[model samples]
Target: MKIALVGIGKIAVDQHIPAINDSPDWELAATVSRHGSVDGVDAFTDLGDMLDARPDIRVVSLCLPPVPRFAYAMQALAAGRHVMLEKPPGATLAECHALTAKAQADGLSLYATWHSRQADMVAAAKEWLTDKRLTRLHVTWKEDVRRWHPGQDWIWEPGGLGVFDPGINALSIVTDILPHPIHVTGATLKVPENRQTPIAVNLEFHHPQGAQVTADFDWRQEGDQIWMIEAETEAGTLTLTDGGATLKINGERSGTAAPLGGEYPRLYAQMAQLIADGGIDMDLRPMTLVADAYTLGRRETVAPFHD
Candidate 1:
C-alpha cells in the first residue's frame, strides 16, 4: 500500500513516518505539511496539492491535531482514498461517526487508530483480566507539559483537548483492556485561570458488573513522569506501565517471545490486516468517554498557568 502522511508535526516525524517506512505493507509515498517535510519523501504544501499530484497514494494517515482532522479526512474519503485517523479521531464523536458512515457507504477502509492500545503487553493484560472479578481500577497519567509539549500554542486553543490530549491515551488503553465497557458517571475539570481547557481532570466510571474506575490526569507534574493503569482483581493485581509496553501480573513481570514492536509499526500492520480483511475497525468508546466527560464534568478555576 502506498501511504501519504498528512501532517509533518512532531509526532509525524518522530513516529508515523518511521513506522510507515518500516512497514513491509506500506510505502512512504508522500507528505503534506506547511512547515515540515521528510527527507526523501514527496512533499506538498497541503493535502489538496498532495492529492492532486500523487493519485497513487491509496491510503492517507492523518497525524494532524484532532481539530483539523475531520476536514482533511472528509477530503481524503471524498477522493476515494482510504483514511486512517490518529487518536481522538475527531474533535467530537459526531464527526467521527459521520466519517465512519461515509467510509462504509463508499466502501473505503477507515481506521481510527489508538497507537497505545497496540502495545505488546496490552493484549496480555486484557487476556489476564478475562474471567476475573475486579475490585477497583485506577489510572495515573501525569507529565509536565513544559517538557513534553514545550511551547505548542494550539494545545491551549479551543478543541485542542489540553491535558486530555495525552490523557486520552490512557482512556484508549483502558477501553481496550477491560473486559466490559465503561461509562462516565462524573467528572471534574481543573482549568488554569488563563486557559480555556482543563490542565487536570478527575473522572469516575463504573462497569456493568459494578467495578469502579477512577482516572487522574494532570499535566503539571514536574518530577518523574507517570503513565500507568492497574486493576485489583479477586485473583491478583494486573498492571500495565510504560504506555502499556510492560505488564505485571501479581507483581511479576509478564513474558513474551517478541518483547516489543514499536507501537506505530504495530498499528500500521494492524491497519493493513484490517484493510485486507475488508473490515473497518475504529472504536469510538474511548472518544465517547471524553465527550461524556465534557458533557458531565464540572469546572473549577485554578491559578493562572505559565509555561
Candidate 2:
C-alpha cells in the first residue's frame, strides 16, 4: 500500500518513519511538513500539494498535533484514502465524531491509534483482569517536560493537552484492561500561572460496578520519572510498572517485558486489515472521556512554569 505521511514532526521522525521502513505491506510514498524532510521520499510543505501529486496514495498517516488532525483526516478521507490518526484522535469530541461520520460516508478506514495500548504488557494486564472485580486503581505519571518536550510550545496552548499528554496514556490502559466502561466523575486541573491549560491534574473516575480509579499527572517533577498503575481487586493486587512494561500480581512478577515495537506499524497493519475487511476500528471512547473531563473539571491556578 502506498502511503503518505503528514506532519514530519518529532513523532514522525522517531516512530512513524522507522515503522514504515519495517513494514513490507506499506511504502512511504510522500511526506508533508512545513520544515522537515525524509530521504528518498517526495517532500512538500503542504499536505494538499502532496495529495494532488500522488493521487494513488491509498493511505495517509496524520502525525500532526491533535488540533489540526481533524482537518487533515477529513481531507484525506474525502479523497478516498484511508487515514490513520495519532493518539488522542482530535482536540475535541465533536471533531472526532465528525471524522468518524465522514470516513463512514466515504467508505474509508479511519484508525485512531493509542500508542500506549500497544505496549508489550497490555495484553498480559488484560488477561489478568479477566472476570476479576477491581476495587481501586491508582495511576501516578510524573515527568520532567523540559527534558522530554524541550521547546515544544504547543503543549502549553489551549488545545495542546498539557498534562493530559501523559494522562491519556493512563486512560488508554485503564480502558483496555477494565471490565466495563468508565466515566470521569470529578477532576481538578492545576494550570500554570502563565499558561491557559493545566500542567497537572488529579482525576477521579467511576465505573458502573463501583470500581474507583484515581490519576495524578504533573509536569513539574524533577529527576527519576514515575509511570505506574496499581489495581487492587478481589483476586489480588496487580501492579504494572514502567508504563505497563512489567506486570506483577500480589508482589509476584507475572510477565516479562517484550520488545517495544513501533506503535505506528501496528496501527498501519490494523488499518490495512480494516480496509481489506471493509470495517472500521477507530475507538474514541478514551478521547470522549477526556473531553468530558475538560468540560466538567474545575480549574485552579498554580505557579508559573519555566523551561
Candidate 3:
C-alpha cells in the first residue's frame, strides 16, 4: 500500500518515516510539506498537488498540528482516500467525531491512533488489571518543554494544549491499560502569565468501579524528568514507568518493558489491521475526559514561562 505522508516535522522524520520503512504493509509513496522534506522520496509543497501527482497513494498519514488536522483529513476523505491521524486528532472533540462519521459515510478507514497505547507493555498491564480489584490510580508526567519542544510557539497558544499535550499521551496509556473507563471529577490548571494554555495541571478522576485516580502534569521540571503511573489493587501494586514503556509489579520487574517490536511499527500494524477489517477506531473517551477537565478546572495564574 502507498502512503502519502502529509507532514515532515520532527516526529515524522524520527518515528513515522522509520515506521513506514519497516512496514511491509505500507510504503512512503510521497510527502507533502512546505518547509521539510524526506530524503529520496517524492516531495511536494502542497497537499493537493501531491495528491494529484501521486494517484497511487491509498492512505494519507497526517502529522500536522491539531488545529489543521481536521481540515486536511477532510480533504483526504473527499479525495477518496483512507486517513491515519496522529494523537489528539483535532483541536476540538466535535471535529474529530464528525471526521469519523464522514469517514464511515464515505466507506473509508479513519484510524485515530493513540501511539502511547502501542507501548510494549501496555497490553500486558491491561491484562494484569483485568481480574484485579483496583484501589487507587496515580499519574505523574513532567518534563522540560525547552528540551523536548524547542521553538514550538504553538504549544503556548490556546489550541496547542501545552502540558496537556504530553499529559494526553499519559492519559491515552492509562485509558487503555485500565480495565474500565475513568472520568474526571475535578481539576486544577496552572497557566503562565504570558501564555494562553496551562503550564501545569492536576486532574482528579474516578472509575465507576470505585478506583480513585489523580494525574499531575508539570512542564517546569528542570532535570530527571518523570513519566510514571501507579495502580494499587487489592492483590498487588503495578507500576508503569517511562511513559508505559516499562512495567513493574510490586517493585519486581515484569516482562516486556521494552518490547522487541517498536511502538510505531506496532502502530502501523494496527493501522493495517484497521484497514483490512474495514472500520474506524476513533475513540474520544480520553479526549472527552480532557474536555471535561477544561470545563470544570479551576485556573490559577502562575509565573510567566519563558522558552
For every model in order, what is the number of clashing pairs?
0, 0, 0
Candidate 1, RMSD to the unseen true structure: 1.4
Q: Which candidate is the best by TM-score?
A: 3
lDDT of 2: 0.86
TM-score of each: 0.97, 0.97, 0.97
Candidate 2 TM-score, C-alpha based: 0.97
Q: Write the per-residue lDDT of candidate 1 for residues 1-307, one digit (tens) a residue.
A: 9999888988887888878888899999898899988888898988988888888989999989889999999999999999999887999888998999999999999999988888889889998898899889999999999998888877888889989999999999999888888999999999999999889999999789888799999999989989899999999999888778888999999975243348889889988987898778879888889889999999999988888
Better of 2 and 3 by lDDT: 3
Model 2, 20: alpha-carbon shift in Å? 0.8
lDDT for residue 84 in candidate 3, whole number 0-100: 94
Distance from true location, Cα of 35 in model 1, Å: 0.4
What value of lDDT does candidate 3 attain over all alpha carbons? 0.89
In the range 1-307, model 2's lDDT, one tens digit per residue, is 8989898988888899999889988899899898888999988888788778898898999989889888888988888888888888898888988988998888888888888887778788998898899899999989888987888888899889998988888888889988788898999999999997889999998878887788899988898988899999999999987777778999999867866564567776777888888787778777777787898899999999887
